[model samples]
Target chain A: WLHHPASVHQDGITVEGLIRRSLEAKEFAYCPYSRFRVGAALLAHDGKVFTGCNVENACYNLGMCAERNTICKAVSEGYRSFKAVAIASDLIDQFISPCGGCRQFMREFGTSWDVYLSKPDGSYVEMNISELLPVSFGPEDLSMKKVLKIPNKY
Target chain B: WLHHPASVHQDGITVEGLIRRSLEAKEFAYCPYSRFRVGAALLAHDGKVFTGCNVENACYNLGMCAERNTICKAVSEGYRSFKAVAIASDLIDQFISPCGGCRQFMREFGTSWDVYLSKPDGSYVEMNISELLPVSFGPEDLSMKKVLKIPNKY
Candidate 1:
């Protein structure tokens, strides 16, 4: 556990190349509207890495975060389980953090996966999905039993 | 404008085939979690239609709304401009409404496009993007001038 330099590294999670790939992916950010670029590198359970950058839309709320972009691509490509995800941005004062929507998206798979929020200088802080989204709403609440009837209120 | 039936049709916007397509698309919803299915059919400016159903993830927040799914698919297929979109759901008591996230996603294109929120009985309520999300944040808010420098706070 390299706890010095004010960085938290997760147990058994190798972040050596993940952080760098996220930084590289930031170059592809289509953020003409925000001018705020972000990138992510997601490591699947099978050891494949998916890199993605923020794709902003004309409507600010439609803008997809780097974390969600990579995760959704991985999901669409048939990757269900993931090991870790590393995020990068140009902000030097504080390490990059996933937005609320991205946090929810990351929580969709499982909670124990590592998330590396890194700075341009490679310093990083690690946290799991549960820590990021406490008391989260997941699939269980909607589907309890095979015969659970939800209140029909749209 | 079909006023007495409580269904509003936009001037020169055709939604006859769109509503049926949306309802048909609902059969394909990948919603093992919520059990609440939704579907959308988007009409591009070039007379093409794209249909999508809600794709739910084990993570509740990661669920992609049908409206967004159709719009994103259309956008990826080189359809930047759209005329209208019709949404369908099983709830017959009231017409289905887009979630806050989908409303924002729909607003990404423009404020003038029509949205037909429909019930299983083929009745619908029409509203525009601006009516759904008022005083919205858009591209102009971020990129106002060529020399606008945003506050550098992460």
Candidate 2:
């Protein structure tokens, strides 16, 4: 059985249900240029769920990725820690992993995060952030500058 | 006159010529996934130039931005400090700025990097990284972590 980090069933919420919601959100994807639609669902540390889709632009450089969009949405709403993420793309026949850059971005949020990918039949594969990004770089590598900035200078 | 921070040009290297080369590199863009191709040129600290284009994927989340690709190529080749960058896109009619994520990635290399947006008429708009990502987050922010391992600490 595919495990959702946190399942919701108030009034109307289920794994299949949320996946469908996110898939519907894919329609809002602004991929006029690429025609590849993607959607992401994020579960916050506090159990709040937020969803976002790729927002493309005429200037492709300015376009936002589904993962980045979800991160920005969570950050803007004041959520820092993430418990889970689900990404879906309708273009390919099989599920694929997030790109290197997205892995870096996801690492910025935290390493304990879990990621899910959906099969066409609605089943999914699950993995933790560590599995996705092994030996990642993060806030820890910048220690020297902080030591220099502190007034104590000890 | 435009300023380049860490550029190293040979006896005959010109910014105008580099821009043209970057534009040509746009043809190599793997944007069948996004259909919006972008190419970038980086004038490195060692008087060498690097060029790259967006490599999109069927899984939209697995694509790299033109700027990130250029930076990664330079970093992989041992060039961390960037003097200037030129970006050209085929889809957008107006100037397109790098997304916030790219801005932060650029900051990781150097906060004072120079950025140029190329125009079809052979002219370009030059701006520094500070102007592009004002009050940006950088390596310094990473130093505040409670533990070096991130989310694992929680």
Candidate 3:
């Protein structure tokens, strides 16, 4: 069923080369801690492809996943809007999804953006960022004006 | 004086190229959301330099700091131990230090590791990881055997 990439209507966006790039990106993962390699590729509105691999750290929490890394790289390069993203992991039996932290990160961009989850062999599933992280918080939540109005307990 | 790098004794680790790299890395920060740019450089045991810029996401928490990014890149490339880390930010009046998350992340490598906080013009202050993040939690605290024994509330 994964054959027809053009037919997979994810908010009217097609999955053309993201899956391949995601798979290719896996080779760059630095995951000695978990031994779980993950790769991600993002397609920007300008048709630019940004790819990232999981970079693990001795401190587990400090590690960054492939999806977040890709988004970070894309943003650093000045691309704000994204069309689609594809993620691939080595887990063949089950499709792995973006973690809570990454989902929250993705929500900062666009909730309607397409997300593809894939296994080693390229077989995959698709979902939108909204479905992955429903009712998420964003820049709107960090209201400095509201915070300053709180009475000092001390 | 800032000119004499050797005088900046950060727990006995001398300030070398870290300051320059940190400043240069700042150019790549993706911080459209916060507009707070940060850059970091890590010196590995082998004397290799890994640099990173703060990569922000739409979900603020999903953002990766320059310090963590440097560590991730270093670790992913197969370097486990680190010698010193340098951080640079745009905050000119005060030297910007690593946040709590980055501090906890740095503690994973070594408590005594040198940490340098710098401004745009290369003026900096130095501290060790332990001093920055005291009474920190780490992998050791996650003793699964002990946690498993705790009775389930449900």
Off by over 4 Å in 1: A1-14, A144-154, B1-30, B34-62, B65-154
Candidates ranked, most accurate by lDDT first: 3, 1, 2
Candidate 2 clashing pairs, residues 3+ apart or interchain? A34-B34, B6-B83, B8-B47
- DockQ for every prediction shown: 0.17, 0.19, 0.30
List, residue by residue over B9-63, the lDDT tens digit for candidate 2: 3525576776777788788989875577788888898768899988876545556
Q: Model 1: how far is B83 from its true place, Å? A: 16
Compute each candidate's TM-score over C-alphas. Answer: 0.56, 0.57, 0.71
Model 3 chain B poorest 10 in a row by lDDT:
B1-10
What lDDT does the true structure give each of the candidates?
A: 0.77, 0.73, 0.77
- What is the lDDT, from 0 to 100, of the residue A103 in candidate 2? 78
**After superposition, candidate 3 runs with Cα above 4 Å error:** A1-37, A44-50, A53-63, A77-81, A130-154, B1-16, B32-34, B46-48, B57-59, B76-79, B134-136, B140-148, B151-154
Task: Put the candidates in TM-score order, highest first.
Answer: 3, 2, 1
**What is the Å distance of residue B116 in model 2 from its true position?**
1.4
Q: Which stretches of candidate 2 lie over 4 Å from their true place?
A: A1-154, B1-12, B91-93, B144-153
TM-score, B chain alone, candidates in order:
0.87, 0.83, 0.85
Model 3 Cα lDDT, one tens digit per residue, B1-154: 1334456433333464678878888888878789999988888887787788898765566678888877766654556689889899899888888998888878777788888888787777778888897887765665445635657878
